[model samples]
Target: MAGNDQAACADGPDFGPLAIEARGLVKRFDGVTAVDGVDLTVPRGAVYGILGPNGAGKTTTLRMLLGIIDPDRGYRRILGADRPHDVAHAIGYLPEERGLYPAMKAVDAIAFVGALRGLPLKEGRRRGRELLEQHGLGYAADRQIRQLSKGMAQQVQILGTLVHKPRLVIFDEPFSGLDALNQGKLERMMHGLAQDGTTVIFSTHVIAHAERLCDEVAIIAGGKVPFAGPVDVARDRIPAQVRLETRAQDGPWRAALPADARHEGSFWFFSLPDTGIEPLLRALIEGEAGILSLSIERAGLHDAFVAIAGEAAARALEQEKPEELRR
Candidate 1:
């Protein structure tokens, strides 16, 4: 079996090369397809993101890849293993639904999680304390999970995920509930992991987080990924845009605007074509159009999502609850 060969080839659950590779993954629930055929690849030492809206099958896909649930049809290779369970010891998973014993102290909870991942009790406790101190939560280490603030609890849970020093860390909506300050801390932690040659993959409904953190991203919508690749490639889906607010709405300057120019409120917005804006500026000047303000905006991940996934998905994303709530 491929799994047997892989197990024998490595001393442990080594990544070999890629941290994750899945192909033609499909899963259904009660006859309704939850995940369509999908392929995902994540390289070692990279920060990858699975981005989608609520109920978009991101969770289903991740579950299948992790071997938490069997796929209706597909195959996955995680950390050189034919199945995730074969390499479970190399992975640290933080599920979307976070739970900790309410009565357990923060440090003890972390050590318990580490123990579940095969770490020794004493080592787990030692690492837990160090992690808490490094993350500015040393004072809360003795506090009960229920006594800590939401942000403190979240940090404690994340520290537990890393207590075993996994080669690949997977987080399902790790930012689901946190304030801006805590979110920043999580971002820094992810970057640190990648710098240390640990692969990080996380699912998120929030575009800003992925845009800021991901080296590569997959945009899942309608139970499928319409786009997946480098973050820069996605941003390039749309060209730079120029927004101009002018006193004169009509005149030769009107002709200067691109046919695709969109009028929104007092400003006209149009893609900044490769031909450049010099000609447009001259035309506006010749037409005596009083330009109130002009600005150029680069395409963002949200814009790419709208272009690839459609306005409906983009609207849903904007309307989705703030990444703050119990999963």
Candidate 2:
């Protein structure tokens, strides 16, 4: 329904050259629809993101794409393959619920997971050791996962995902339990993967992470995608804002301001006018309004998310995180 041709196809579905494509993907659990007619396209080598809340069907959608679970209706393809298992060797996935053998050594755990992905045990062990050393976990290789810190354990899981050298990497709520430092590390890892021509796709409720790491994103709320596209396109969906402050917040210069301008705490804020700010600046100068400051705040991913999904949903996601995490 959302820009998808739902009609039956005679020649089968054409997913074009996309790394990932979903045509009217739908899922239901106990009569309740988890994913409702969603379609997505992730270009090759691009960092794509699914932005949504905890229960917004993000996990369900990802699971369906991975063939971990089948959709009730519609179809999905990955790396031009009709099923995930067909290209299973070409993909790496990190699930939201972290899992590892607590009694297993860090390196062994990684090697074991890699072996499952078709990598030889010896090769997996070699690559796993190198990855651990590169990620500053060299000394912990022989240590049991239970003996490692939460962050270190998480890093081990991430290394296992990469040991196979997959062409596409998918992360489901990768930032869920990490601290800011670990989150930063994960961001760098995603960048590194994309730089190596890996198509990275991650789902998270945190919009800031998407803004920092993703080239394209789809915003889902209440099991429906209200917006999806390039990061710049999402930002452009809302108008920019202008904030002005002056000693005198009145008189003829005030008349030049847009009707939507609102006065709050010795400042005037409003949507930036399409004509230009030059005319407004000139008017203020001529009227001797003593302009203290003027600035334009370009719409950002967070603003676009709020505008599209509403403040209630935004607040629900933000909660009361630390200032640094929010930034």
Candidate 3:
């Protein structure tokens, strides 16, 4: 049973080596080429993120890796195992599109999913209840899932995915339909799982969470990966920039830096090709411009994402131009 092997990750890193690896991964649906030659690598026990705009093939890529859909080309490995289907016992997935047994009680819903994964019936029920209560949905154990709020229902789905205690977890837009409160809860849950040695890979269009939650990130667009690196390393590579909010007077910072600095209201922001910012900062202290605040601004995943996904999102938008024009 899949559940019998579900806790297999507890003994060691799945199959060891790379937790997830894909080279020249390609997939097509209806001949549109949803995923094209994408490559990815994820370390064991790390929180990895994939950022992309809609239709950038993030979902399709995940589907292929999870063995739900077959990629037309390329190769992938999970926990050193080439067969994703065979490794299903160690993986849990939450898709952007949700499916639940609405008529079933919340506890029963989660248990049902665990049962399919080969979880023992008694343990499945126990885990279902524990996860529900831990997520603050305990009181709704006997309540029908359809009667819960959208956010509560979303939680039920998330619980279902992890009920069997899989070693690798994948979330597709896990934060899409929730308020700030619930999003925070999910974030905490993810962190907790990672601390327990679960390897996690999730995709999102939002950059802030990826910046905070992931050790490394990959930005994909046009069915390809344009950037993949450690968050700090990626920030350092994109050019060092600075933001200063000071009095609008003739400050030395304005005079000492390169001439290309931009003024946004009273704030001056500029990027330096070189990292030697000491000279400029020293000049600012000497001038006494009453510097309200100074902050180093590095290029973030959002910037790289925009630089990469911009073209793809635009193409998707353009494809809908005719329908939009009709409106």
Clashes of 1: 0
In candidate 3, where is summed lDDT lowest over 10 consecutive residues? Answer: 1-10
Q: Tens-digit lDDT track for model 2 on 1-327?
A: 000110111122333558898888989999999999988999977899999777889999999999999999999989888888987877788999999999999999999988888878998888788888887798999999999998889989988887888878899988877887788888887887777667889998888889999999999988888888899999988878999999996788888889899999999999888887898899989988899999999899988999998887788778733466666
lDDT sort, best first = 1, 2, 3
Q: Which candidate has the highest TM-score of all?
A: 2
Sorted on TM-score, best first, the list reads 2, 1, 3
TM-score of 1: 0.84
TM-score computed on alpha carbons, candidate 2: 0.89
Instruction: Please give the lDDT score for candidate 1.
Output: 0.85
| Residue pairs with backbone overlap in model 2 | none
Q: In candidate 2, which residue ranges exceed 4 Å CA deviation?
A: 1-17, 247-249, 286-288, 320-327
Each prediction's Cα lDDT score?
Answer: 0.85, 0.84, 0.78
For each candidate, what TM-score against the reference? 0.84, 0.89, 0.83
lDDT, candidate 3, 1-327, per-residue tens = 012223334333436646899999998877788888988999877889987777788899999889888789999988777888777867889999988878999888888887777777678778788777666678998899889999898988888888888889999999878777888888877777777778889998667778889999887878888778787776665676788777647854557766678888878888863647777777777887767887886787655555655765635534533342335
Q: Candidate 1 clashing pairs?
A: none
